[model samples]
Structure formats: structure tokens, C-alpha cells
Target: MVRRGVLGYVLVLVGGLVVSVLPASSAVASLPLVADLRSSTGGRMLGLAVVVVGLGLASSAWLRLVRAAGDLGVREDDRTALVHRATAAWTLPLLLAPPLFSRDGWSYAAQGVLTHLGLSPYVWTPSILDGQVVEAVDPMWLATATPYGPLPLVWGSAAAGLTTDPWLLVVAHRLLALVGLALLAWAVPRLSRWSRVDPARASALVLASPLVLAHGVGGVHNDLLMAGLAAVALVVAARHGWLVGALVVGLGVAVKLPAGVAGVGVVLVTLPAAARVSARATRATQVGAVSLLTVVCIGAVSHLGVGWVHALGVPGEVQTPLSVSTQLGRLAHLLTGADLVDAFRTAGSVLLVVVAVTVGLRSRSGDRRTALRATAAVALALVVLSPVVHHWYVLWCLPFLAAVELPARGWQALLHASWLGGLVAPLDSSLRGADAVIAVGVAVVAATALVQAVGHRRAEIRAEVRAGAQARTGDASPTSPISR
Candidate 1:
């Protein structure tokens, strides 16, 4: 474990140094600080190489951490501590770097600029900003209003803070994201214990995930913040009262709209059985009222108004790859030679609702484990079906999914596949030509890895079952230690 920690930290530190010194997006490069490095194509290529290498190292380190976590004999608290230490070692350097791999960080700063100007982010684009902030934001988003929730926008407003420097604002926003990581670090282990998962294993799965650290913290996306808060809400729901948990979940949704979906599982868990139809309905109504009211009250306090709802459908306007809706749209066109993009999108939405309802109903078993699994199922269904899917969005489903124990190799398979897929795929564009080829290559590798891992796990389970059966049979035999 110590060796793995040291290796992971070294690789992460090197990666951070490389990314920090390298030129970033064009908008960031336009700044005087990195003007010289910006012009060097070779330098940028070298930096990219370093970043990829770093990711590989981090991925390896995670495997080692998983191995450490597999020692069930270890104290749960001690394992949690190790996971936390590993997270800090791996995350801090990436945080210090200038938004390692995505231009979205620049967009975040620009959105903050818009908020600072008292413009409703839902109605106006960053193009309204007439300075470096304009250049910092991607043109794709220039004509489109922000789809971010009000809480993140409000944070952006504070981050903007009279600084015309886009870099400063980007750093400020990243710092805010750091707070969210801290929240996750604190909440995940507790949530794991409450959910009856091995706290150490759960912590390792979440904290050491490349998707969480690389795309989440490194890109400085607000989704991590939302996820952190949502984790807290889940923990509260399990250990404390439902009303307070409802409020916390609402706060998470205020950061990003999807966080509210998790509340469905929370509410379902509180409802009585279907036999008590009227009582169940009453409980449902109360939960809905409190949850929605909490969200509205939080929005009101943020002063962003409810206009943000107008942007809720904005993400659908952009078609991202690897999403169920996007692929379905393509399939429809291929089958009928007609554009059924909108129809397919609507279908995906309907499918997601169906899946969420099914999972929520399943959660009515009233077990915290069932509720968490339900929450994960709903989140996974939503991400798979959503019109827009950033690779980082996978992180949304990870915490709860991790809480449900699977065999170590099964979890490893998922971790490797998700990490590889997330690393290769871009959120904004469909994979095509060479990019598609490369993504396919990565998928093939990940699939192969999964098969191998799954095989090993199956063997282990078989062995365990055989051993248990033998022990039972031996115990039943009267001659076996006098039936002791």
C-alpha cells in the first residue's frame, strides 16, 4: 500500500508539473504568461504525452489501492484513512495545474463573468462579455445560454470578483471544486458504513477513480461539487432525518439539475407499502412537496430566479456521443433514411422515466442498501439516456454503485472500463475516423481486461462456494468432531 501510494503520488506530481507548464486552450494561451509555450507545437505534444502517461500511472496506482482495500481483515476506519491519503496525494497536484485537459474550465470562468455582470446565465451567453472572458469561452456555447444550475452560477459570480483575468477566475472556481472533493472525502466512508458496504473499499472506488480525479477535479467541473453534496445527502438520509436529507439533496440539485433525481430514491425509501395506498400517497406527496419546496427556496436565496429552468432543456440541443439518445438518433436515421433525432430523444427521455420509476419502486423494500442501489440504478439510467454526456458524468453513478459490494475483480473490471472509456471519449463531439478508431482500440483493450478480471472473480466465487458447502457437509456429519 505504501509503495502504491508513493508511485501514484510521483506520477500525479509529474503529470501536474507537465500540465502546469504546458500551454492550455487558445483562450488561455492568449495570455502573456504562456505566450511563448503556446507557439511551440512540440511543447504541446510533449505535454499531452505527459498527461496521458500520468493518467496511466494514476490508473496503475488505483489498482494497487484496490488490492490494499481487498484485505477485509483491515479495520474499516484505517482503510478509509489510506484512501483519503491516496486521494490527496493524487488530487492536489492536478488541482494546482491549469485545468489539465478541458476548455470547459475557461467557459466556467466566462459564465462567472456573466453572473458578475448581473446577467441571467440562463438567458445570455458569455459573448456579452467584451474582453478576454469572451475568448476564453468556446464558440459552441457563445450562442447558447448556460445549462448549469443556479448554485454553481452563484459560486461563479463570487469567483468573478472584479477580476478580468480569466485564469484567476478559473483557479477560483477550481478551488470551489476542491471544497466539494473535501466533502466527498468526508461523506463517502460514512455513507459506505451506513449502507453496509466496506467503508475502505467504497472510499477507494470513489476517490481513486480516474474519472473522478482526472475529469472531475482536473477539469474543475461543477458536477463533482453536485456529486459531493448528493453523497452528503445520502449519508444524512441513512443516519439522520429524511427532511434534512431532502434539503441537502435540493442544495445539490441547485448545483446541477441531475442531483435532484437521486431524491426520488430517497423519497421512495420513506414511503409505506403499496397495501397502504392512501398512506403511501400521503407520504409521497409530503416528500415531493418538501423536496420541491427546498429546491425553490434555495433558488430564491441564490437570487438567480427560476429562469434557470429555461435552460434545463438546453443540453438536449447538443448531441453528445456514447449517450443512448445520440446513438438511437443515429440508428433511426440509418434504418429509415429520415431524421428522427427529436423523436429518438423523446424516446430516451421516456425510457429514462420508466427505468427510474421501476428502480424507485424496487427501493420500496425499505432497506438502505436497496435504496442506494436504486439511486445508482436511476443515476446510471439517466446518464446513459441523457442527450448530453460528459465523460465526467459517469462519476455521478459511481458512489452509490460502489456502495453495493461486488466481487473485487468485478469492481476492478468496471473501474478499468470506465476509466478507459472516460479517458478516450470527449463530451462535445462524436468519435469519428481516427478518433473513433482510437476509441475502439481502447474499448477492445478494456473489454479484454474485463473478461480476464471477470473470469478470475468467477473462479474465486466458485472456490468460496465449494469451501462453504464442504464446511456445511462436514459439520452435518456426526463423525466430524462429534457434530461440533
Candidate 2:
């Protein structure tokens, strides 16, 4: 128990809970303890204190849970799966409440609902008529008012059209996101099964992860639709079929261009595995079927034309700490007069390209052995290294990490904490003051993940060494590295 990471997780969570439970209303005495960002002279300090404590608690709880996952180990499949389940499960309550500072979720819902009404959402600002209730979309989104993409608009419209109330629209969108999650839970395992991976563990990692709960359910970002589609596409491709694979992957790209990272992995799988003409043809057949499926479904749903293309006109979000806007802010502060916002957008775009190339190179071997891992790294790296990274963006990486075979306790602990920090960045004023927290936290978790992956390589090498020695000596009494 002492060696396991659970003890740390439990302690931190309890400490955070204690802090959170404090009566923050008595700011006359507690003002001194308020975070710097919340250190405003006004009575807002009391509310700020509460938000800070809550964010801290959430961050601690998330990290501890990740550590718990590491403690469970690979061989303990059921137990390990349970850990991911525990983390994934919390998403239920958090999402039921208000949109937890996830402005993106709100905008997505707003756009979808508007589209469903046959209104040009991008052109019709949520700021129109009522207050800026749909605050997530571009200020110019309504002005640009062009149709973005067919799929997202259809989804957004349906979700939004469910109710006239902004709040209700958010709820319906989350429900739709939940449906996407069901597809993910079903699809990832099936993909693993067909690919001969650790089907139980792989499925567990994805289906039960804390990150998924936080973002998919908590943030309720529409990226889940993209990820779920991507996973199904992989399953199709890995089964040695390509047409359906292309269509699904294409749909993923339609939802979010970054979702296209999976296509790189698919391309890798297609090359050697389909090296033979017959295999290549079979793969082509699958791709064609998938293409047809996507085309027909999207066509039936909406008019796939200029209106849909216009939906993507709103390129970057500038309000939150997580986007290219953040970098732009810093650079503008440095460079005499150039806009940091412009800098950030440029930097983020370049980053996406780099991550794509890197993922492509790593996955070129065309084996499922590293396919998911490489794809995830590519996806995550794109977000992490970008000028702006959002909490929901983490959803893009969780599935790959879930399916990864190795788990390092220390690194997992870091990821757990960082995931929580992502949640905190929006609500806590302290985070704004101590903005450094997010940057440091993200670096820590990313480093942790890298360490865990590398550590596995070292462990494997040692195991091989021990096995070779045993073979030489023909010893039966010594222990095996993996048997425990």
C-alpha cells in the first residue's frame, strides 16, 4: 500500500476536500489566504477563494486517480480496468451541472441548434436578440454566418433545436456527446480485438479513463464524435478493409480537422499489411465502402456545399488561456507592437503541421504494435505544443493512452493532476493570477507520460537480459520479471 500511488492520491484528495469545505464567505479573516488572482479589494474575494479551493481539490483528485491506475498494473486486467472506470465514472455528476466553464461546449451547442433551425449559425451571432448566451462561438461567427461543415452543423443544429433555452441546448449537446461515448466504448475494444491487442485492458483504459470523464462528459466537447468516428475507422482499416475506413476517417476530419491524425495511422497500416495486390485490393474495397457510407449519410443529412464550408470560417478561439491567443498575448507583450493574437494563430498552425509529420514518420512501420500510441502522441503533441491547448482537447489523446500497454506510476500521477488542472483553468481566478500553474502542470504530465513510455522500454530490456541469463544457467528457482 505504501509503495502504491493510491496513498498519495488519497492524501491529496482529502487535503483538497478539507480546503474546499472551508466557509469561504468569511473573507474578512480569510482574505489574507485568498489567491493572488482573487486578491481583488472587492467582496469577490470570498467567491474567488471557493473557486480556488475547488480547483485545487479537483486537480489533486484527478492525479491521485491516475496514480491508482498505475498501481493496478497490466496483468491485473480487471482491477486496472476498475481504476479507469472509477475515474471515467465521475463525469456523470460534473456534466449534469452547468457547463463547467467549457465555453466551447456552449458555442458548439448553439451553432448546432441554430443550424438545425435552418439558420446560418455562423452568420447569426448568439449575441443577437438576447444576451451573449452562446458565448463560445466567434464574435464574428454570426456575421460570417456561413455553413461550416455538414456533420457538425447538423449535430449542432439538432442539439440546439432540442430546446429554445441556451441552458437546455448545452444539456442536449452533452447528451449527444454521451451517445458518442457509447460508440467509443464499443468501438475501441472491438478494434483492439480484431488487431489482437490486449482487448480487455485496451478497452478498459479508454472506456474508464478520468480524462474521458472530465472532457467527454464534463466538458462535453464535440470532439468525442470525431474520436469515436476515428476509432471505428481504425477498426475497419485494421480488419483489412479501406473504403469504409476512408469514409469514417473522413467524417472524423469533418467534425474536427485534427481528428485527421488517425488517418496517418491508417495510412501506415495500409501499406505493408496490404503489401500484396490482393490485400491492397481488399483494403481498397473497405476504403470505398467507408467512403460511400460517409457520403450517403452526410448527403442525406444536409446540403454539402458552400454553406457547410463556411462553418469553418471561425478558425481560432481567443478568449481562453488554452488557445493560440495565449501565445499571442505574450508575444505582443514582447515585440514592440505586433499583435500577439496573430502570432499565436500562426504558431499554432505551424505546430499542427509539425505534429502531423512526426506522427506520420513514427507510424510508417505499418503495425498496430505502435499504431495507437503513435497516433495519440501525434494528436496530443499537436495540442500540447500548440500555442493554445484546451481542457477538452485532452479528449483527443485519452483513447490512445488508454490502449497503451505500459503504465508508469509516477508519470500516471502527473497526468492525473494535469487533467484536473485543465478543468480548473477556466473557473479559478487564481489560475489567471498564477497562470504559470497550467503551463507547468501540462509539462509535468507530458513529461510523466514520456517517462512512463520510456521506462517500459528499460524494463523490457532488463527482462530480456534476465531471461537470457536464465536460459544459459537453466535455473528454475529464480523469479521471472513479469510473473510476480
Which structure among the candidates has the greatest TM-score? Answer: 1
Taking all chains together, each candidate's TM-score versus the true structure is 0.82, 0.65
The alpha-carbon lDDT assigned to residue 129 of candidate 1 equals 73
lDDT of 2 by residue, 50-69 (tens): 33343334444443443333
Query: What TM-score, to 2 decimals, does candidate 1 have?
Result: 0.82
Tens-digit lDDT string for candidate 1 (225-304)? 88888878877776665787787887887788788776765665555444254554465566567767876886678776
Task: Kindly report which residue stretches of model 1 are placed more than 4 angstroms away from their true locations once superposed.
Answer: 1-42, 272-277, 407-410, 425-484
Q: Which whole-number lDDT from 0 to 100 does residue 397 have in model 1?
A: 80
Q: Which stretches in model 2 have alpha-carbon errors above 4 Å?
A: 1-77, 80-89, 129-148, 159-162, 187-211, 273-300, 304-308, 311-313, 317-362, 385-387, 405-420, 427-484
